[model samples]
Target: MRVAGLVLAAGGGRRYGRPKALVRHGGSLLVERASRTLIDGGCDPVVVVLGAAADPVRAVADLRGCLVVDNADWVTGMGSSLRVGLGALLATDSVAAVVLLVDMPGVTAEAVRRVAAGAGPAVLAAAGYPPGRRGHPVLLGRDHWAGVRATARGDTGAAAYLRAHRARLRIVTCGDVADDRDLDVPADQRGGRRG
Candidate 1:
């Protein structure tokens, strides 16, 4: 099964001073990096959910093969973006999707590949730090899409659904390949100490 990818890049980033999708890191927009990460990680079709400053992101980002989704309710939170991204995937032949957050620049293509390796129609896996620190690039099989869509609320994303079904979840250790820390404020882009 070809695992798809979802990049949730809709947040206005009130705390970060602007939309994270337009933020530059390593000379490329965050949105561009994320979309490329998924494609390079072996995801056949990638979907990018955009909300805040969607037009500017579309104009500059090289999202040639990505399916761009405009989440109108993005002001509400990450939940809406997740819901929108998942909904878009559910309509296609996508067996599963690996969800990546736009602000999490530390996550790499290798980490995404690691997390997506265990994808299936009934699989649920997430990248984990040492000692099982669950993080993004979560792979949700089609079987759990409805559950995630229902439980995802506010900025929680799949936390509620994942928590309820913790026993069946697979934790992929990606601490060596990537970092899950996200940029929340402008200072976060100052190359903060990673410890």
Candidate 2:
């Protein structure tokens, strides 16, 4: 199946005091790192949703080979970004999508590839951290796009939808090979060697 990459980079970074997409890590912007991780993990035609400081992110982030999408309703929350990204992926010939967050600089391509390798048009997969915690780089099959979009609201993203379909969800244990830390606050930004 053809699985595309969907990077949600529209957050305003209200908590972080700056657009997280533009945040630098390992000599590259966070958005660039996220997109590159997806591409390296085997996703084709990566689609990135941009909103907060879209112009500046475009200017700094090397978005070459990516399908950049503008989410006008990004201020509303992550749900809008998710909807916009999934919609863009739906327009393609992709059978599923590997969803990554721009703020999660710790998630590596290995994690993305592990989840994406098991994704299909009707499959649902997510990266699992230690102690059975679920995190980003979610694999949403095309079959669940409409339902996920319908339930996606506020900053919840696809949490509700994924919970509703928990019986069929697959959890890929990635904690052993990847970190799922998110750069949400200033303290997270202070860490060394991100990404």
Candidate 3:
């Protein structure tokens, strides 16, 4: 549906001691895998937001041709990065945007596709994972862009936007997968499967 794919990879990853987006998962870096999922799910004009380790992360992922936005104010918080990323998308031709987190390596292509396909002016595609936990690659329509950009502050994310507009949210279920499985800590980067 001509949606924009935003990869939120600007975090410092202080808990993991390095950039989590470039962390190896299966055979590819997490950011690359996430981008591939978005591209496969029908998103065009994808953009990746970089911060903490922007240079090495970009080099490791080989994102030479892809659009990249630097979130120099990343230290401010996730919301700052979100605003930066969204601002970049504003210059593009995307009618809808599915914002993905670089740490979520488990977010399947099907999950992304389902969300992107259901985007609308007010309806947001919320991730329905186990225990009813909603998470990112949340699809935000162009209508919500202004409000989203205005309200983002500190660590607060689009969740505030969803809460303020609960009636407009369209929950898209994606089985038992924990699309919210973010690899912030070392244990989380280990696939959350202990032997």
Please tell me which model should have the higher lDDT, number 2 or number 3: 2
Where does the lowest 10-residue lDDT sum fall in candidate 1? 186-195
Cα-lDDT of candidate 2? 0.91
Candidate 1 lDDT by residue in tens digits, 75-162: 9999999999999997789889999999888899999999998689999999999875789789999999999999888999999999
Candidate 3's TM-score reads 0.91
lDDT of 3 by residue, 1-195 (tens): 468888888888788887777788779887788788777777788888889888898778866445888999988888988898889988887888888888887788788888888576665777786567677668999889889988888878787888999788888887554356777777865666421
**lDDT at residue 106 of model 2 (Cα atoms):** 81
Query: For residues 1-195, what per-residue lDDT tens digits would candidate 2 score against the true structure?
Result: 789999999999998899899998888999999999999999998999999999999887898989999999999999999999999887799999999999888889999999998678999999998787898789999999999999999999999999999999999989988887888887886774333
Q: TM-score each candidate.
A: 0.96, 0.96, 0.91
Clashing pairs in 1: none
lDDT (C-alpha, whole model) for all candidates: 0.91, 0.91, 0.80
